[model samples]
Target: MDHMLRRQIEKIVPLTDSEFDHVLSFFVKKKYRKHQFVIQQGDPVNYEYFVVSGLLKSYILDESGKMYIMQFAMEDWWFSDYTAYLNGAVANSFADCLEDSELLGITKENKDKLCREMHKIEHFFRVKSNYGYVALQRRIFSLLCNDTQKKYNELFELYPSLFQRVPKALLAAYIGVSRETLSRLSISSGRKTQED
Candidate 1:
């Protein structure tokens, strides 16, 4: 688990053993069962989590009670309500475990302190935030211009593990397709794979 966090950080900046230990010391390890809520809507968002294992989904419930999946965080991913975490606002979305999950969490206070104390850590986080922003922009563009097939293909290409780990209905929701449409696409994909 420590290696996982270290590996992610090392991708952006190298950290000496003692530096890594100091960084890790600020995090709190936690485990949640499948279907448990890590961050509930309207609650205070205190911690941003790094997934050590398993999967989690962040989604919003509309006034009509429609659920739209915003994102999924699997192993080695970081997730939270960024607006809430950064601005000290309340969360408007829910983050829940899709499977039994282990996570490392850091409070906003500690995270800010770490960044202030370490230039490399600040750079690392800034790079991560930039990547997250780019991903969001791509997702927005895809939603605006892509057809269902294109969206599905792009999603599958980016996170193939989601196809196996997520349920068809939730996958359909993420792709903005009806369950029947997703089923048809799945069948088509299967036939294509078989022919190959």
Candidate 2:
């Protein structure tokens, strides 16, 4: 867990030995079963998960109970209801496991403790959030502006090798399209792969 955390942090900022130790000391490990809900809408969002392996997703269910995929966090990714977690408000989104997941978690309380103790950890979070925010902003802009075909292309471009492992329906939801539309897009592209 410490190794994984260090690697992930290194991607954003090089941490000193003591800083890494300080951050690692605060993380708590947790596991979730497939199809389990890590967080439900209206719950108090307490933990921000750092994905060690497997898949998790953040989504919102409308009044009709239909889901809108907000994001998927695979290995080395992070997912949480940021608004709720940071502000101590009720979550409007649900995070669930698409596959059995092993995660490193830090609660809002622990993170605050770390931030107060180690300025470096706070800096690490700020930088990491900046990167994530930019990427999310770009993804949202593309989804809102582009056609389905373009969105599919952009998704493949961003997550180069994930199509083989993830279900197409989930991918469709992530790209803001239907399964049938994705099928049509695939056929139109001269691809002949069958779904797993």
lDDT of 1: 0.91
TM-score of each: 0.95, 0.91
- Candidate 2 differs from the real structure by a C-alpha RMSD in angstroms, to one decimal, of 1.9
Candidate 1 lDDT over 124-195, as tens digits, reads 999999999999999999999999988999998998878878888888888888888988898888722211
Best by the TM-score measure = 1
lDDT of 2 by residue, 72-169 (tens): 88898888999999999999999988789999889999998998887767888898889998998998799789999999888877875567666778
User: Residue 138 in candidate 1 has what lDDT?
Assistant: 97
Error of 1 at 80 (Å): 0.4
Sequence-dependent TM-score of model 1: 0.95
